[model samples]
Every structure is written in structure tokens, then in C-alpha cells.
Target chain A: MSTAERTAVTATRTRGLRRILRPRARLWLGTLAAALILFVVAPAALSGYQFGLLAQFLCYAMVAVGIGLAWGQGGMLTLGQGLFFGIGGYAMAMHLQLDDAGPGGVPAFMSLYGSGTVPAWWEPFRDPWITIGTIILLPAALAALLGYAIFARRVRGAYFAILSQALVAAFAILLIGQQASTGGSTGLSNFRGFFGYSLADPLNQRLLFFLAAGTLIGMVLLVRLLMRSRYGELLVATRDQEMRVRFLGYNPALVKTVAFVVSSVFAAVGGALFVPIAGIISPSDVAVVPSIMFVAGVAIGGRATLLGPVLGSLALSWVGAQLQDNYPSVWSYFQGALFVLVLGFLPQGFATLGGVLRRRKGDSR
Target chain B: MTTTRPLALEVTGLRVEFDGFVAVRDVDLTVPAGELRFLIGPNGAGKTTVIDALTGLVRGTGTARFDGHELLGRPVHRLVRAGIGRTFQTASVFEGHTVLQNLDIAAGLHRRPTTLLRRRRGVPEEVLRALDTVGLDDLADRPAGELAHGQKQWLEIGMLLVQDARLLLLDEPVAGMSGEERAATGELLRRISRDRTVVVVEHDMEFLRNYADTVTVMHRGSILAEGGVDEVQSDPRVIEVYLGAPLDAPTATATARATGRETR
Candidate 1:
């Protein structure tokens, strides 16, 4: 071969080698940076109030992680994550409420709103262990059952999205109507403690922040594990060509259901943490509007990537908080404009910005 | 060796209906093990539908027993699990995945739930073998969407091969292929069918004449003719209803009716 031909071959090989190596290295680096920032940097820099806000955002970020898996990777397009989040928050919130009320004492809201007695359904959550278990298990069971029914029947795309939205809407309405049992429209709030730690203490507040941070990291690791596994490839295969996967002696329904269950668990855990961080869980929080917001964050962040949902939700939550606190009324308009522009221009989200620019450069050649 | 290998596909009283219209009515067919059987007909001849019925894609009321397992009543995945695998006319593959990943996913019937959660340690022996068989080993890392039309069709075949299916049903495997790709696919088909029973639902008469061990002709749902390639080609019923028409010529009766039948 000529020297130029040899040089060209080496260059091509080098580029191919780099293509294989870069993504894995970048993934590890990005994960480490996220860990350092979340566990160390953020806590040190922000004040307790600001840190609490970040903690709340992390809960949403956790929910977004599942969305990234289900909607982004699995092509589920789950829009009712708020329902699971609400379930988790309510599960945790009820336990705390019971703890606050103490032995045999009904919560103040029940006596004031309706009957002076707790419902039979509210009885199990009095045990903290049961409450925690309920937070995880309920969403898993619900998502599995719901996902199987929908997927097995081959109801997908817009129909699935609409069904999810309707379910969340119904959940919100059910909570609101159950005034005596579920604290009515105000929902559950004013927690004195989490597990045993006093909520008012600054140290414990920081501990809660750490818990949120640790849990978010754990969830990311869990997602990374799923995305790398053989099931991950199957999930993507099911997403892109479901019937093809079905014809390969694998049930697409089962694969889809697994992702949905995991997504719900993530949202539920985030919601459970939100109870302590935000100090409230209401019907408005778990309704159609908030459910759509979770999807919006995933869409803006780039659902397909692991960190996209986490970073996207954090950005949206932070920006929304700033606007709500300062601009108030105009925040929605500005947020709407931003949403329209991002989806219009970068439909894959900000995660694909690097790729988009590189593509445009290639176009010039 | 011929007696040692069992029968692959046996159908009796197979009938399929959509609404009130019958697509395939009372068709019975069988192929001995390891036979490269071809099902050829003009459009709406129910050639693809017969494969679809056997594979459990469409709800067909009949008994299709493959490798001693009943196929007709089971779901698509269950039939696949029962050692039956099929491909589509418009090559179905995971567009985003690499060729290796596509094969790896297909070669996952025996993968336990626990092992599924871990990343692939290295290339599996079966996936590599399939890649070599499909002539896609060099392009293993390339995204399936980036492959040529012939390559995509080959990849689809490779997927079924990795699946280790006993009964392989291929629908129009070489549609729109250049002469070179067509010849290569015919050779590949012959290689893959040495042990496994392969049923090719094809249109290209040239391909069937060259490679098919046996041919089953369908016209208007039921079987028109069935025999060895040269024998079936000369059959008057097959020529009158099917082979006599220009290969690309769409019949008025077929075109005006059943446009939606091909999609499912």
C-alpha cells in the first residue's frame, strides 16, 4: 500500500477506536462529577433554605430518571408519573401524620373535616416499615398491572398517554373527595419528624438533603445497570420494533411492564422524599398538571440519556422557582415560550446539543 | 439421516377470516424437515397470510403443528417459543442498535431473568456465528439503520438464525434486491436450511427455480398447486392464476381490494 493509503487507514482506525472508548469514559466522568456536585459541592455552597429547595428539585429529578428509562429508552411515553409520586408521598406523609398524632389520637384534619376516626385503609401506614413498603410496592404492583393490560392489548402511542393522564386525573379527584380520610384538598402537611429525626433541626435537614442526594445517585446507578444489561437492549428493541421482539420468543408486554414498574418506583421514591423536603403532599401535586410537568422535564433534558432527566428537571425546577418567587404571573408565559422553543428546535432536548452542532459542522463539508 | 430428522410443519383445515371476508379458506400444507419450501403467488394470493396464520400473527382457526407443538391458538411469542420464527416483508430490526446488539437481543430465548440485568461480557459464540453467516461480521458495530437494503434483509434473517428457531418463515426475503444480493441470499438460504426447515414466501420465480427444493402455489387464499419447482412451474393452474401474469403487474381484482391485508 502507498504511504497515504496507510496513513488514511490508521486515521480511520483511530477514529473508530475513539468512537468506542469515548462514550464509556464520558459516562463514568459525568457520573463522578454528578456525585461530587450533589453529595459535596451543593451542600457546602447553598444555605439551608437554598439547599432545601435543591433537595425538593432532586425529588423531581428522581421521578425524571424513571421517565428517562420508561419514556426515553423504553418508548413508553409515561405521562402519569405524578400518580406514583403522589402515592409515595402520601404513603410517607400518612406515616408521619400517624407518628405526629401519637397512639390512638386521630389527625387534627380528620376531626375537623369529617369523622373523628381514622379509616381502616389508613391503619396500615401507622407502621413506618409498612408505610415504606407501601411506598415501593404499591407503585410496582399498580404499574405492572396497568402496563400489562395496556401493552398486552397493544394500546400504545397517544392512547396510552391519554389513559395515563386520565388515571392521574381520577387519582387527584379521588383524593380531593375523600375529605375525612386523606386530609381533603389541603392534603397532608406540617411534619414534625422523619422516621425519628426532628424536622426543625438544621443537621437533620442537611441529613434529609444527603438522603435525597444519595437516593438520586442510587437511582442513577440503578438506571445505568438496567440500560447496560441485556434487558436494556430488549427494552429498546421492544420500543423500536415491538412485534419483532415478540417474534423472537420474548413477550414485549413483559419487557414494557418491567420498565414501567421501575419508572413508577423511581417516581414513588422521589415523591416519598418530597414529603420531607417540600413538607407537603397535595392533590395538586399528583394531578394531571404536575404529571405533565414531569414529562416536560424529561423531554427538555433528553429522555434517552441517564443524566438528561436529572439535569433537565433540576434546571426547570430551579428556573421555575426563581420566576415564581420573583416574576410570579409572567413565569408561566416565559416557561411556555422556553418549552415551545426547546421542543421546536431541539426536540431531543439539550442532551443532543453537542451532536446537533457536530452534525451542522459536517453539513458544511 | 432423512428418516432420523422429524417433520417440521403440518397444517390441516387452516382458514382465516377478517370481518365476513375470508382471506385464507381451508388450506392444508406440510413440509418435511430441512426442506427449502417456497410459497409463491400473485398479490392477495394469501401466501403471506398462510405464514402469518402459522406464526400466529393473525387469528386463524386451524391446526398448525410444527416440530410436535401446536401453533394455531398460541400467541406470536408463544409460537416463537414453540420453535417457530418469522420475519416481515419490510425488514424489521432495531434501527438504533448495532448489528451485533440486534443479533444479541434475538439470541435471548434461553437467557434467564437474573442474567438479563448484567451487561454482555463479550460477544456470544452464537451471535458471532450469525454475523458471519449473514456476512455482517465486518459491519457488526454499524447501526442497523445505516445498513443497505439487502444488508437489512440479511440482518433480519441473521436474527432468526441466532434465535435458533426450528421452523423459519421468511416473507419476501429478497424483494427489491439487486441480482447480486438475490443470488447471495439464495445461497445463504440454502446454507441455513441444511438442518432447520425454512419456508420462503416469495415472489421471484427466478429465485425459486434456482434454490427451492419444493414449491407451494397459492391463488385466492387456498392452495393452487404444490410439488417440486419444475413440476409446479409447469402445472396449468399455477400458470393460469399466477405465473402467467407479468411479475410486477398488479391485477385489478387485487389492487381494488385488500390494501390493508399486507400491513398486519
Candidate 2:
């Protein structure tokens, strides 16, 4: 074939490929396009401070995605996700604090508040890799253990909710009590660097924002894949009728445990990233209020849909930040009213709001 | 179908007590493979409890075995994996799923190590076949929650059919079915009995009379009589318990006639 003819054939082939990328492929492509705009384009457009705020919202969005999976799909009502998130944040914060401290040195907080010596528990976190590993494993292990014990005994519904909330309360108390190791109620902050990238640099901060956005996109994609699988069907089935699932030869407890563990790991990863992005880890962050706020964001977004929780959380948190800045006194009240309105009117969340409107229109017709 | 067939389910001295109120008491029952046996009694007679004990849905102090496997202490899932499938008194289905998806979940139940990442797109032939059997193949894409009560019952039974369960314990399978649906269900149960052990706990006397090969009558949590449907109906003790009159009373024949004409 001649060069001109070959070039024409190649162009047609590319056009064919583009045409084939319709519907499902188009959905993924759209998501990718949106992600690029958000993580890359938006970062480029926004100031450093605005980008950092966006990154912080992304961290909460990460937690909301996990809540959507567990509470929305699995029917777990996991109000204590902050427990996992806080644990992950603390793990990362401790490692950064240790890194800021020179070798053969304890974290500055330990010297100031604690005895001059480093606690035995804090020693392992000095290794950045260990800290990262702990952030993933610890919360996952706790969720798995708790899920097994509760689900095996068939403790569910409101009881399970209460038990998980109690665990968060207890975790917050434990962290607060361990002043020397945990830096007490004020939590850990004032990080000098992240993996040797200086936090003092605006470029590095922007990079951190990109990293968070990238992780959120990856986690959302992973959850989307899971929701389309047989396991996802089984999880929903278990939620609807556990005894029926057992009669079909599935251990519902095991299915629920898997969902709980996956959600916890997501929260943990979110928490770990939160440390560098938010630059703080404290008892107040991991308490019941934050845990419930995580649920509220999911509820506002629509619990069952893939992107609802992420978008809902980001929007709510951003609005909250704005509210705090402009109307600090009434912002919380506004937040409560918005949540109430969403619950009363759009129980399926904003994700299904379009469907609800369409249905009402259809009824009129 | 034959006396020579090995027993598929065997129970001895089976008893279930809930908070010291004896629900099932010292029941001794044996069912051979490939037989359609019906357990019938009035309300609160522990007919369902015996099934609960056999399927490990409720703890019972007795020996219950299915195909030589001890089932008394085993969990519900193990019993299911060992080829015992049960339907609830109130039809319990994955209501949010389409008819095909419900069957798919059932058909895929025995698959080992359900993968975490892969999407399950294909429906198993067994699920398709079961849907066809229950005549729900035409409506396979409709959500089960939207199905009529009778259809939901059929879907659940179809779920058991997809599992290829060796032993089926159906609790009130025709509770809310219309007469036509009940007749179809009777035909389906007869078909299922051709190659499997079926123990149906029902209050529908006419259905048992038309379809059951053997009938076990329960009264006050124990077997009152056990035999062919005609024999159990004629058994003097069964007549008294069912008719609320002595077997030799003047009202006995009238009561028998009334019961014979009753459908449910």
C-alpha cells in the first residue's frame, strides 16, 4: 500500500475505535475526563490554598465512598468509620513526626509532654513503610474481628450500630488517655516533610493534592468494579434476606465481614492521606461526631450509587468550610437543617433525585 | 417410592424447646430417598418446628442425619451445602434482584472462593433451566419484589431447584397461592419428587391427598399418625384431633365429609 493510503486506513481504524467506545466505555471515559479536570485541570486553575482545601475535601470523600459501600450496599450502618480513619491518620502523622525528629531522637511531643524516651509502641512507626503498612492493616484487622464477632452471633440492625459507635467512643477515649504516645487530645501536627518532599513548598502541597485525588479516583473505580461483581450481588442479597442466603449455601457473616473489612481499609487509606493533606490528627476528629458526619455526607449524596457518596461528601464539606468562614455561629444549624431536609425528602439521596423528579413528572402525564 | 431405598433423612428422639416451651417433642421420623412425604397438622402442631430442627434452623436435642451426615449441630449453610434446601414460611427472596439474578445467585452458591474483582455477567444454564421450569423465564428481567405473591413463592422454589438440592424442605409452599398456582405447584412438587427427597410441611389437606405418597400427622408436637394419606385420614386418633370429636361420635362422618370437600 502507498503511504497516503496506509495513513487513511489508520485514521479510519482510529475512528472505528472511537465509535466502539460508546455507552459503558463512554461512561468510564467520561469519568476519566472528569477526574483529569478535577485533579489536573482544577489544581492548575486553583491557588495553592484552594487546592489544599479541595484535597482535604477529597479525603472525606474517600471515607464517604467506603461508607456508601458498607452502609448503602451491605446494609451495615457503619457509623464508626471515623475510628478507622483516625487510626490511619495517627499512623501517618506519627511517622511524619518521627521523620521530622532526627535519627536516635523521639518525637518533639514525647519530649515536651511525655517522658524524654520514645514509647515502645512509637518505635515501629519510625519506619515510614511500617507506618504505611499499619495504616492499611490495623483498621482492616479491627473491622474484620468486630464483624466476625458481631455477625457470627447475629447481632445486627440498631444493636450493631450502637456497638460500632461504642467502639469509636472507646477508641477516642483510649487515644486521649495515652498522652505520651498519642499526643493527648490536641493530636499530632506540625509536619516538616512528607517522604522527604518538603511540605513548606507550594508545589509539593499541590502534588499532595494530586495524590489524594488520584487515590480517590482509584478507590471509586475499585468499588465500582466490586459492585458489578457476583460478590456484590451476594452482599446485597445477604442484606435483604440473610437466612435466605444461608439456605442458598452462603455464610452471610463472611460476606458482611468482607464488606466491612473493605470499607475499613478505604477509611484507613483516606485517614493516612488525611494526615499530610489536613496536617492534623486529633481525638476530636475520630470521635462519634465525625463518624456520624461521615454517614450524613453519604446519606446526602445517596448511599447506593457509585459517585454519590464521593460528590456528596466533597460538596457538603466544602459548603461546611465556606459556612464556617462566613457564618460560623449558624453554619452547624444550617448543616443540620440541610441534612434533615435531605433525609425527609430525598431518602435515596441526591443520586436518585433525578429519578424521583422524573417519576413525579410521569405520574402527572 | 420403594421400601428398599435407603433413608435420605433419619431422625430419632428429636426435641426442640424454645425458652422451656416445648415446640417439638421426641419425634422419630424417617424418609426414604426419592419420596414425596407430607407433614400435616393443625396450627401450632410443631410441623414447621420439625423441619426447622432437620434444617438446623433451630437447635434440637436429637440425632438428625441427611445422607449419613449428622445435621443436628451443623449450621444452616452446611446443611444447604450438604444438599438440603428450605423455603421460608413467608417467601424470602432477594426482592431487589431481577428473577434471573435471584436464580443466578442461587446457582452460583456452590462456587468456591468467589472472586473479589471480576464481574459476573453470565447466567448459569442451571439458573436458566430452573427459571424455565417455574415458567418465570419470560419475566426474567423483572425485579422479584414486583412479582405477585404466588410468583415470589415459585421464584423461591425455583431457587432451590437451581441449587440442585438433594433434599428439599418446603414450609407452606402454597400458603397464599391461588387455586391455579397451587395446582401448578403441586405438579412441580410431583416432578421434583421423581429424583429427590421432598418433605412438605403444609396445612393444605387436599393438596396432600392428591400428591403425597405418605402423610405424617402431628398433634401437640408429636406424630399422631403416619401412613398413606387415606389411612392417616381414617386413623381414629387423627379423626378425633382433626374433627374435634370422638371417632365414634355421631358427628364423625359429617365432619369427615366436610373435611374431604375442603380445599385448604
In candidate 2, position B30 carries an lDDT of 88
How would you encode candidate 2's per-residue C-alpha lDDT over A175-201 as one tens digit per residue? 999988898899999998999999988
lDDT of 2 at A136: 92
How far is A342's C-alpha from truth in model 1 (Å)? 1.3
| Per-model lDDT | 0.88, 0.86
Listed in order, each prediction's TM-score against the native is 0.93, 0.93
Runs off by more than 4 Å, candidate 2: A1-23, B1-7, B244-264
**lDDT per residue, candidate 2, B43-63, as tens digits?**
789999998888888899989
For every candidate structure, what is the RMSD over all alpha carbons to the true structure, in angstroms? 6.8, 7.4
TM-score of chain A of each: 0.93, 0.92
Which window of 10 residues has the lowest lDDT sum in candidate 2 chain B? Answer: B244-253
* Predicted candidate 1 versus true structure: per-residue lDDT over B1-264, tens digit per residue: 022253568898899999989999889998888899999888898989888889888989888888778888799988887778888999988999999999998888867778788898898888988999989999999999999999999999998888878788999999989999999999999988888889999888778889999999888999988999767755656656752367834432243233325333
The residue-by-residue lDDT of candidate 1 on A1-365, one tens digit each, is 98545655665565676687786796677678888998889988998778999999999999999999999888988888899999999999999998899978788888898779888999888898999899999999999999999999999988999999999999999999998889878999999988888999989988898899989988998999899889999998998999899999999999999999999999999999999889899999999989989988889999888778888999999999999999899998998998899899899997776666556556777
Q: Give fnat (model 1).
A: 0.94
